[model samples]
Target: MSSTEHTSLAPVEDDARLPVADPGLGEHVERYTDTDPAAARRAYRQVVTMFGLVPLLAIAFVVVYFAVPQDLWVPLLGTHWPLNNLLLGLTGGLAVLLVGLGAVHWARQLMSDHEMVEERHPATSDAATRAAFAEKVNAGVVDAGVSRRGMLLGSFGGALGILAVPALVTLADMGPWPTAAVRRETIEKTLWTEGEVVVNDVNAKPLRPEDLEIGQLVNAEPASLFDLNGHDYLTEKAKSALIVVRMDPNRIQIPESRRDWQVGGILAYSKICTHVGCPITLWEQQTHHVLCPCHQSTFDLGNSGVVVFGPAARSLPQLPLRVNAEGYLVAQSDFTVPVGPSFFERDSRNDYQEGDQ
Candidate 1:
C-alpha cells in the first residue's frame, strides 16, 4: 500500500475502507535513572548498600539473643520490655524493611523499564504454544540484566542467608536443659519451706486462720518468694501459689495420711490446676469446689482436692499447713505432688495414689 493509503497515527479517517489501526502503546518516557548513567549507578549502589546492612542486623540479633537475659526489661512506649526483645525487634524489623526497600529501589531504578504491547489471546493454550510462552519468559528473564551484577547478587544472597538468625536464636528456648534434680527443684518445688510464712497474695501480709472466715478462700504464696530476684521470683510465683480455704471442721474430710495438713479450719492447696496449669481462683463456697477457668476442671477442696467434675483427671496437690508460734499460717512442707501441666519425664514419684494422671 502507498504511504498516503495507510491509517493515520492520531485520529481516524471517516472512510470505512481506510479504518484506523489500534495505537499499540504510549511513547516510553525515559526515567532519570535511565537517562542519566550517574543516577542509575547511584540507585544501584543504594540498593546494594541497603541489602548489605541486612547481614549486620541479623548478626546483631544473634548477639542480642545471647547477651540479654530473658527477664531483662527496658522502658519503651511507657512499658517495660526485655532487653533481648527490644534489640531483636529493632534489628529484625530493620532487616525486613531494608530487604523490601532494596527490592523496590532495584525494580524502580535499575531494572529495565521498557514499554511493550502483548496481544491478548484465549486462556487455553496448545502444548507448542505453552512451550513458546516458557521460552519467551526465559528471554524476558535474560533481559532483566541482573545475572551479571555481582554486587546486587551477593547483597541479596547475604540478606536471605542471614534471615535464619531469628529462627536459630529461638532454639535457645529448647535448651538450658533442666537436669532431673534441677527440674525437681525448679518446676516441682516452690519457695515454700517447713516454716515459711504464708502471705496474702494481694497485700503481702502474713496470713492467719483468723484472717479467713468459714466458706472464705484467699490467694496465698510463701513468704520466701518475696526474697527471690527477678526471673527466680516469677518461676517460684507460678508454682508457689496457694489457695487457703476455711470450712467447718466437720465438713472437711482428712485422709489418714494427711491428718495434720491443715491449721485450725484453714487448708491450703496449690492454686495451679493439675489438668492444665491455669491460676485457678474461681471458688465455689457452697459446693466447696475450686474451678479452673481454662478447662472448667473442678476440684473439691472439702475432699483432698479430688477431681469432682469437668475434664480434670488428677487431684490438686495439697500443701501441708501448720500454725507457727506467731499464730500465722505456714507450710509444713513443699507440695507432695509435682505442680503445673503433667509434662512427660516429670517426677513420677509424686503421682496421685488415686489413679494415673
Candidate 2:
C-alpha cells in the first residue's frame, strides 16, 4: 500500500458490536488484601482505627474549649497567637479530617476493586426502571460492608454529636436582658441633676462663662461623675457626657421657650448621636455642626440640636444649662427628652415636669 493509503479489514459481527470488533477491558490484577484474608482484615482494622480516632479528636475539641484560657498567647512568626483559637481549630478540623481519611482508606483497600461500566440509557426512564435503580443503590450500600462495620458507625455518630456542645455553651455569653427600670435608668436618664457642675472632660475642672471662647466646643461631663464608684462612674459619665459649644449670641437660634437653657450663648447637648448612639465630637465651628464619626450624622448645636443632615432621625437631646452661684456652668436639670437612639418600647414623653427645678 502507498504511504497515504490504508487497507480496510472485514467487519466482525458479534453481540451488541458495531461494524467493528470491540477491544475489551484490560487484564484484571487483584490486590494483596483481596487475595489474602489476613491482609484484608489488617486493612479493615487500619480503616476502623482511623475512624476510632475521630471521636478522640472530637473530645479533645471539647476539652480545649473549656480548659484553654482565651487571653493566653504564644509568640510565633513575630506575633502572638491565641492558644484557645489554635487548639479549637486543630481539634475540630482533625476530627473531621480523620473520618474522611478512614472512609477513603476503607474504599481503596478493603472494599471491592473491580471496575464496571454501563451502556447509555434513556434520560427519562419508566417507573419500574427507577425502582430497579433504587434497589441497586441499596445493594451497593450493602456491598460496601457498612452494615457489618458497627465500630465505624458508632464512632462516627459519637464524633458528630459532640461537635454541638461548644456552640451551645458559648451562647451563654450573650448576657441577660435588661429589666424595665434598668433600661430607663441606664439609657434614658443621666447623672445630670439640678446645678451639677459642667466639668471639662480632660481636666475635670468646672467651666465658667469666661472659660469658653466664641465658637469653642468642649467635650464635658457632669461633676457628679467624680463621686460615683466602681462601674457606676464609667456608666454615668458615658450617659452624662456633653459638648459645650459657644457661638455669637446674635448668630445662635434659641427658641422662645428654651431661652433660659443657655448661659451667654454657651449651650450643652449630648455628645452621643441619636443614630445608633455613636460618640460625636467632630465639630465644624463655622457651620455650627457636629458630625458622628461612625455614620456621619450631622446635628446643629447652635439651634435646638436639630438634625441638619445625614441619617439622624431625631434632634440631639439638649442638656439645659445655667450659670450657677459660682459663675460655673451647671446643668439646670436632666434632659427634657430621652437621649440616644430610638427603640420600639421607649417612653418618648418628657419626664421632666414643669416645677421639677
Candidate 3:
C-alpha cells in the first residue's frame, strides 16, 4: 500500500475531554499512639515538657542579659571567654530551638495522622470555597485537641509570648544619648595625667630622651596603663598609645607656646589616626611625617603634627612632654584636646592648629 493510504488507515481517537480516574490514597498505617491511649498521653506529656523548657530558657536569657557584665571573662578550655555572650547565646538559642521542636513533636505524635491528597484546581477560589477552607481550619484545630489540651496550648502560647522579651530587653542599650559629660568620662578620656611617665610599649620600661635618637621613632604608652587589667587595660591603652619622635633642634618648627612642651627636641603625638582612629605606625625620618597605614593619612610631626596629606581633617593630637626628676620622659598633663576621631560633643575650636603659638 502507498504511504498516504497507510497513514489514513491508522486508527483515530475522538478529541473530546474525558473524566480522570481516581488514584486512591495508599493503605494507611496506624501509629502506636493511634492504637494505644497510653502512648498518646505519653506523647502529649513529652510535647508539653519540651514547650515548658522554652519559658525557663527565655527567663534565663533575660537574667544573663542583665546580670552578667559584658566584660566578665571565664576560663573555658584553656581560653578566657565572655561569660555574658556565651550564656546569652546558649539560653536564647535553646529557647527558640525548643519551641520549634515542641511544635514538631505535637504535630507528629498527636495531630491528625490520616493521609490527605489535594487535586489540582483553579488558582482563584470562590466565596463558598474560601468559607469552606476557613471551616476546615477550625475543624483541623479541633482535631489537634487544642481546646481539650489546655496545658499544651498554654505552654506553647507562653513560650511564644515570652520569647520576645530577650529581644526587647536588649533595646535598653540604645539609650539616653551620649551627652557632653558622658563623652568626657568615656571615649574622650585617657589615662595620661601630669607626671605620668612615658614607657616603651614593647618592653614596659620608662623612656628617657636618650633612649630615642634624632630621626628615630618609638611607640610608647603611659606607665600607669600597665596597672590596669582586662577591659580597663584595653580601653586605656587604645587612647593612651603614643609615638615619641625626635628631630634636630634646628630642623623643626617649635611654636613659642609649646617650647617647653618638648624635651631636647623630642616630641610625642597620639598613635591613633584622626580620620577613623587607626594606629599611626609608618614613619618617614627625613620628612618627620608619620602615616596611617589604613587610609594613608599623613601627619608632619616636625610641624605640630599637622595633616600634610590624605583624608584626616584634624592633626594628630600632640602630647605635652617634659623631663621628670628621674630624667625620664613624662606627660605634663592630659592631652590639650580629646584624641582619636572627632565626635558631635567635642569642641573642635580648641583643637591645636599648625600656626597656633
RMSD, each candidate, Å? 8.6, 8.0, 5.0
Once all C-alphas are superposed, what RMSD does model 1 give against the true structure? 8.6
The sequence of per-residue lDDT tens digits that candidate 2 reaches over residues 1-357 is 789999887786675366556667778899998899898789788877777777677778778878898878899799999998898888878877877787788788866677776799989999999999999889877767778766656665665666576557667556446567777666778888998899999889999999999989999999878888756787887788899999998987888778899988999999988889889999998989999999999987777888878897788889889987888999899987777787776765643322223
- Which candidate number would show the highest lDDT if scored against the true structure? 3
lDDT of 3 by residue, 64-105 (tens): 888998988999999999999999989999999999999998
Point to the candidate with the largest TM-score.
Answer: 3
| Overall lDDT per candidate, in order of appearance | 0.83, 0.81, 0.90
Task: Give the TM-scores of the predictions, in the order they appear.
Answer: 0.82, 0.63, 0.84
Instruction: Quote the lDDT for 78 in model 2.
Output: 98
Q: Which segments of model 2 are wrong by more than 4 Å?
A: 1-32, 36-39, 173-212, 218-244, 249-272, 276-287, 291-296, 317-357
Give the poorly placed runs of model 1, Cα more than 4 Å off: 1-24, 69-82, 122-125, 174-182, 228-232, 347-349, 353-357
Scored by lDDT, model 3 comes in at 0.90
Candidate 3 residue spans exceeding 4 A from truth = 1-24, 65-86, 120-133, 171-177
lDDT of 1 by residue, 258-295 (tens): 77888766899989988778989999898898999999
Best-to-worst lDDT order: 3, 1, 2
Worst 10 residues of 1 by lDDT: 348-357
Q: What is the lDDT, from 0 to 100, of the residue 207 in candidate 3?
A: 94
